[model samples]
Target: MTFACGKRLFALIMSPFYFFQSRRRRLKRQKWRKRLRRALFPFLLSLPPTVWGNVNDFALIEGVRIQPPAAAVLSPGTSQPNHPSPIHPLPPLELTAGRVLLQRYGCTTCHQFGKSTPAPTPGPALDAIAHKVSPTWLAAWLEDPFTYLPASRMPRVVLTPTERREIAAFLLGLSPGWRLPSRPDLPPDPYRGSDLFDALRCQQCHRVGGEGGLRGPALDRLGTKTSRRWLYAFLKAPHIAQPGTPSHSFHLVDQDALDLCEFLVRRAPSGAELPDDFTFSEQDTILAHRGLRIAIERGCFQCHAVRSLRGPSLPMPAAASTADSWLDHHRATGETILQFHFLPTARLAMHRALQDTTSIPNPVALPSDFWKLPIPPQGSTPEAYSPENRDLAPEACASCHVRQWEEWRNSRHARSLSPGLLGQLVDEENPGFIQHCLTCHAPLSEQYRTVTDGDFTPDHGITCAGCHVRAHRYFGPAKPDRRLTASRFTGGQHGDAVRTPAFRQSEFCAPCHQSDLAGLAFDGKLLQNTHGEWAASPHSAREETCQSCHMPDGQHFMTGIHDQVTVSRALDLEIDWKLSPETRHLRATVRIHNRGAGHHVPTYVTPAIFVKVALGDERGGVIDGTLQTRIVQRRIQLFENRELFDTRIPAGGAWLFEFASQLPAHAQLLTVVVEVDPDHFYRSFFEQYPSDSVQSASLIQQAHAQILDSPYILFVRTITLE
Candidate 1:
């Protein structure tokens, strides 16, 4: 054979391998694109996309049609996989791949999925979801996405009970025949179930043997507490149990769900055999009925009927009354029955209902935190209560520790009750979190834990009474310290002062400063790790503590990052500025050393230290292009469940920021400023709260005051070149 003929034969043999290689590369690229979109969502949050024309075509968004940027090129038809979830229904084989690809891409804000329109929400297309899953399952999934799956991509959307039921009713009405699933008839075995749960690593989120995380609730009594029908259906597909959970769905065998459901049912705790006897007063009965009437008129009847309206929502217009009414109904999963912050119009109507003399509630008021003792979020934490005047409350301590008390009175520690702080709540409704704040601030206010809106937080803060008082005794730094005082109200009381290990160590601040946010993990690291940082710092080896620098002489003013003086004292800054006129280059080498701080300079996520080097005029006006900024923060981008970046100076360490900028030949003034935005992160979220909200508005003003009062400005330097 000729040489050309032999070459042709070789080409033919390798053609098949080349075809498969190209296909694999395309799939790999597609997978990376999906992961990148999710990871950088937060960066794009503030930069929502503008209209763009599709590649030589147009797409529909909502009702208006938009032409994507001409440069945009969409995937060529359904040849692309939609990050295929193994169990989700497959697209119709008859439909062209192009048609399916359009449906796959929903939002072009970052990643465009569909060719024509925007999705109403995240997750699978649900317009015909009724045909795929039962309406009951749909409702359950929408209510609590987590109960069903641990790694679901759905974002939790807060909805009223009525809205959830309305949407569910609408969906269930669509298709009736395709609901529910086919599972095993085998009876549930808790023993086998327990083994499966362990194998599946369910303990990562839930606690069973008292060794799991706090992200999910304890499930030892889950079976006894819930309906078996819901459990079976939920196990099959978590979406049927809860809709917007962050948990991931699994491709489990049908029998897996059946066995798990049965085990859960069998493991449930026994119920109280009988309902406890109770009676209602004429006043209480009338109040409940009035509240029920209001809710019904407000369209709450769709989901709750005449029963419980106790949900984990904002307060109603007359939240004190409506929130306490109705106890007979079962709240659906993921349904917020207690969140009562009604809309403005609803508040107006509720007010009118109350004003009417003839209007009185007919529903029974449920037992709630409004009139019940609170369960401490971290179990029982009892503090000392002193009836005698010997107690060193801030006011009483002012007598002997006059200077320290006065300093604390004007410090950030004295002003902990701001709307920004009050608004720091769990994304999921957690009653325990409500009391968590008071655990450190008020420490002993029962009203703080019980009353949501009506009670006033005592202005004690981390007061003199915080550390010294425990039950009926007082704690101090030394031995043989005791005091007794005669009480005007109840004869006399006794208080013995004993040394406490916490007084001399970091543990004193641990209860409040330490936090484990499993949900706020960034690359498998907790976002809030102040206590941990301190424990690992060089300061720990020498037995130095948070109190060492902040309380040099037992000063009550906890000189924190919020105080400019305190901040200046914590770190040292040295800047080297230069002007290379020949090359038109302006250079700076800023060294920030953690001089006194025991941990990261700022210590927390809230404060951000900003270092800016730029060309400026004699009047302090900045020239463009010569500016470079470095931010030192904890990178608590919890919204994305990931950290973008973090650069902070650790104890006995230094951060060197090198900046070189091309300068205009005539530019002679150079300025280097290092300041701190104490409430940088706080302000980011605080802006989301409306000023018209009485509570938030007050807090907004107070936070402004705190930011103003916080420590800032390491130094300002201006260097002039001839």
Candidate 2:
């Protein structure tokens, strides 16, 4: 070049050429990367779970040591049984790196917003998780990602145990579902609690407005008693709120529960000032110690965790050996035993453990007959009958009241007394005989000191005081505006008396009617299936409860199948007939339906009803010796797993019977009858196990008389067959 000047100019030109070569190289590299992605994208998108032999198993390749199956080498995001999986899973090496690059470079955002076309569902969308899973389950799953539903697609995230619980609580809030009633919108309304409490029978355990039972803490002041948030949580999940408390899934509707919360909150006294009568036990050492002793004797500490009372700790049941891990795992020891009993396999494990040691605590209370209620120590009445409600004689109320007294006396609620029931009270030979007979029958026998053993407060039968008095307080279903004060004669007793609608609800009778005993269920059918029947009945859907029918027009007669009038009013029977001359046969078809009753026709194991048909001659001589009997009852054979045939006509269901007989020339009469024997079987049951003393023989005679005289023959028809 000139040479230096020409060389400089050429150099400048060459610099641009070099820059262009470098740019071309970069473009070529990017194109190759894109081509690689196009090839790998489809394969990775398939989420192929390539199963292969252990990666550690080496293979000899031609002149090269082929590494452990490279595909099996998990990516950073891949899940391992021992380790938590990452936020989102991806394949290993180039595939994962390429996808991350594509995401980082904003290549896949065109269609799916971020990541890939088929994007992951955002965590917020899982608000519907409440409809899908239980709150406890969700919490447990989130606590340790693998704990519940290990196959769940939810990736392991950084959250503490408390955070998981809080998230679960929020998620568990009821949301609108396909079915509206099940997932009702809960608008806060405190007023609804007053009626809802009674309707739901919350007072059966919980005392509210000083008119309910003392089984649960008094709820006269919900606002000052506990925080609103805690109350809501407790109502939603009672067991979770206070662990080891005897809580149940009431299956309350969301709207109803919120309404109840509203009422209970408003129940609090104004300005948080306790009532003038409110007494403090902390100042009185004797009262405080008495309460402590009572709690211990009642076994309150068995389930509840009490932090106070630093007395010597009770010894815990020693743990069983885990040599049989399966047995140990499934035994369902301690608190979970009640739940375990419902599960078939767990029951077997628990039963085996029970042979050695009782692992399951029997917490059942309802139908207390199953628990073999303990008899009070010999010749001891807890108190000489209290004067006002002495013996709770049902007639005693007349001494005080003018209106309800006479109504109650005339009602079946008053006429339920009998001598045979009194005999069983003292009879100690068979504890089962002293079951819930007097609890509902003569519910106040303890107050009257009227029974023998008095184990189960076995009085002759029910009286007024039982339902009215609790903790020396009188309660009843008085109207909202009604004012109640101390009983005049029984001073200090029932002072500032309270009334609640729960007194008239079905829950009042649930003690004797609804059996919580697991033993009572045979093949998932209750022996005494009345409550179950009503629960499944359409009447429940219509809001027709037990009290609605039993106490119609404010009458407490409780007239059922035993009452002919009640029976006659409940059924609409129809009969169709056909006579065949060639076959010389007479056939009558009868259809019986539970058109009116809220439950089965006869809703107890004790009653055995029969629909019978017979053929007779006009001269009263048997023409065709045919007697067809259809038993309509559900009975469980005691101490046996087997059950007697249940032929009960379910509510709103029908029972059809066809009677066929050869019509003889002399056969001029056909008779069809539906016979009911209510107390016959029950009397016979008691007669089999009579008491030792004077009461036994009299009770036996009563039993015999019941079978003979108590037979109710309904719909007796005599027709002359042509």
List TM-score per model, in order.
Answer: 0.43, 0.42
For model 1, the superposed segments whose C-alpha errors exceed 4 Å read: 1-387, 390-393, 396-404, 422-431, 445-453, 479-494, 516-520, 577-584, 617-621, 690-693, 696-698, 701-711
lDDT minimum window of 10 residues, candidate 1:
484-493
lDDT string for model 2 (305-383, tens) is 2222222221212134431332344246443221111234323332232222111111111221211112221232122
lDDT of 1: 0.48
Quote the positional error of residue 404 for candidate 2 in Å.
4.5
Please provide, for model 1 over 48-162, each residue's C-alpha lDDT reduced to its tens digit, 9 standing for 90 to 100. Answer: 1221101113322222344333332111111231232122222121111112111211101112221322222222333334344444445556566545543444433345655
Clashes of each: 69, 9
